[model samples]
Target: MHDEGEPGDPDNKSVNSDPEVQQTLEVVFEEGDIRRRKSSLVPSTAPRPDHRRRKTQCFVHTLLEKHDGVASEDLNASYEGLAQERRVDKDPHSHAEQSQHSRLLTKKQISDMAFGIRELSKKLAQIKIMLHVRNIFILAKAHDETLIKHTRETTDWLLTKDESYRVYVEQTLEKNRLFDADGLLEKNPNYRGRLRFWTNELAAEKPQNFDIVLALGGDGTVLYASWLFQRIVPPVLAFSLGSLGFLTKFDYEQYPQTLSRAFTEGITVSLRLRFEATIMRSQDRENASRDLVEELIGEESEDHHTHRPDGTHNILNEVVVDRGPNPTMSSIELFGDDEHFTTVQADGVCISTPTGSTAYNLAAGGSLCHPDNPVILVTAICAHTLSFRPIILPDTIVLRAGVPYDARTSSWASFDGRERVELNPGDYVTISASRFPFPSVLPLDRKSKDWIDSISRTLHWNGRERQKSFKEWGS
Candidate 1:
């Protein structure tokens, strides 16, 4: 029998020459096959240590040294191929010798090796992700000089803090000279290539490309950021600089601390709900062969076919369908999950998300729901019937509202109070919960508490004068 210090043994001086190879072998032996098998193998039943196991490990190190530039995946594939070849080339006549050779690595050893390879692959992947520079997109209120100054300060701070971060602003801001790029570059020449402009067209195409979104101004600015990213919205950090600070909970004065925390230790996010609104138009009414019910039920024909508009909108607040410049009340047929539920004869109807419950829905006397709740609020505007009241529905349901063919006047629909479209007699609008929710970063001291604070501070909820004491009244 060869001694431990022999030329072919794994403990030989020549085998431990290269530090990298030695380190790799140590890791594999400690956590992979060798350590496991040593503890499992019994003295009387187990095969004794032999030259073949040492030779196999030496071959693995040789393979690693020879293919030093190869990828980890390819190296793993090579090892698997070698193991397969060993199984196929066994001698059938010498059963005892074949058994001993194969017993070097049991099924557990192979599984452990694969598991180690996967863990190494995961670490490599994480390192690769960390190498890329983070991209931040800024969305602020338009035409505000004070906010513009604050934005420039924030931009300068970011550039000075991290050379790897790339900052992008709206094209309109650059074109209007609100964000003077030339002046910025003159002051900080190193930030020349790092500062960039993002147009609406580019933003719509690659909404998910940004790592984070920073909103300066009030809730309007935050909503505008939500509108810019129709799908796959990045995490948004909004600073309170507007008239309303509901969505913009963080103070602009504490930007340095807030932003530093966001950069170093990530911020907690509240995934706010949004609505997807689609407009479905019916074919020409004059040439239609089908009745109003048939056309509304989706009976397709050359003249009565229903076609959806080119694009759908992702609304953060609410979608309102109301009488547009008409003196008479509008008649609307509402359907819930494709079933006709009720007819709403009112000035209009509003469908909003839980995040928008405090907006138009609250103004129309709808229930105030928590933003985290998975619900949608449907509120009627000045209904003709006295019994009509606001109702809340699950977010999973799809709601459709259309003007009847015999209605006196056409109705108008607006998404988040914008993109107003006239709904013809047969046209309908569908509203549903979007798969992509807006991820807003909360303040360091806030989570659900921020919402409650906003309601009390902004709206003065439950505010009333206390009754005078009996002694004071008598005096």
Candidate 2:
């Protein structure tokens, strides 16, 4: 008759009420069963404190066992090795890290590390710069004993100074007594192996074989160097050793220093424009019909088919179309950008680049254009008409000069004062800015300053007596 909550009744008493009874129940239930029963009374999502405590104890026990016999020093070394391996995997090229511990590096050690990094950076820079110049082609004035002697001296100095550099001379020089085996050997015993001979054919075949062209003569020598390289021209360092040394600005005396700077520090270059002159024959017109069709259909015309020249020439100075050996004035029709521009009924016409404006263009009443100006100068060679004047056209224009099919006489064409070709009736010449420009190395001065000095010293431009000062005039 006792209630379930009553402590007096033995059968109705709680399991935890009597000590003997509880002990008997504990023995019967087991610890795991008691825990499960208690856990079932609470929410399943609640954290189990005993489980967390057991995990922590297991982790500590494993950690103690792992490091039970390891020394403190060995533990530090293990950590450092792991860090080093990570660094090596990150950047194989990088140097090892110097500071591993928390202690600050001494000032002297830090300075030494900085100096070592700077030295490494300098070595990398030098390695990058070393690949610039290895082969030098020397083009000196022909039939000049003084220049030849100077060339010998230069070759000797170059050979003695740098054993790595290879010198290339004109093949003709090999036959010359000046560059004979005895002469070369007298200068440098190893010249036979280091010095090489190159012909015009070889130069034409492999223009890129020469890294730099050293021209020792007047401006004409520089032009000859330009002529040798029809496609890509290397940097040309011209020494002033001839008459009218306009293009030859570098002093032969200072060549040692100049060349040294060019090799190491590098020299500034003035990329002068060149003209690709192609002579299109009248008979080729029929062959170009297919190219014309291709052009109409928005396809590029083949260069060899459309504007094939009898002999194409790359001119750095000018191209002249004139009455060669003909008494009558030549009749020439000019076209620009495929549009008819004018007809020249003069002795001849001169087409020159800005670099050549100082040459024939100046003599034909054309303006003195700066070499850097991107313009083509057209000047009449003794024009019959007084009103006809020189004209400057953009470099983008493609100039074509042709003899009319009904013309009286054939016209003559000369490229850079050479390679004279006859343009019969209906024949024409196409002139366009060449993709390959003439790279002329500047002297110690900048492009503008060098040009000014050349005109002042060489051409004696504006050399007339300076205007008297106002005070002098008054006196």
RMSD of each: 20.5, 34.0
The digit string of per-residue lDDT tens for model 2 on 198-229 reads 78887776765666789998888988987988
Task: Tell me the deviation in Å of residue 223 in model 1.
Answer: 1.3
| Model 1: CA > 4 A from native | 1-133, 175-178, 285-304, 466-475
Cα error, candidate 2, residue 147 (Å): 2.4
Give the Å error, residue 271, model 2: 0.7
lDDT of 1 by residue, 111-187 (tens): 34334323432332222111122577888764788877787788888887898777887766675576677888889
* Residue range with the least summed lDDT across 10 consecutive positions in model 2: 21-30
Q: Backbone collision count in every prediction? A: 0, 0
Q: Output candidate 2 Cα RMSD.
A: 34.0
Please report, as a residue range, the 10-residue window in candidate 1 with the lowest summed lDDT: 24-33
Clashes of 2: 0
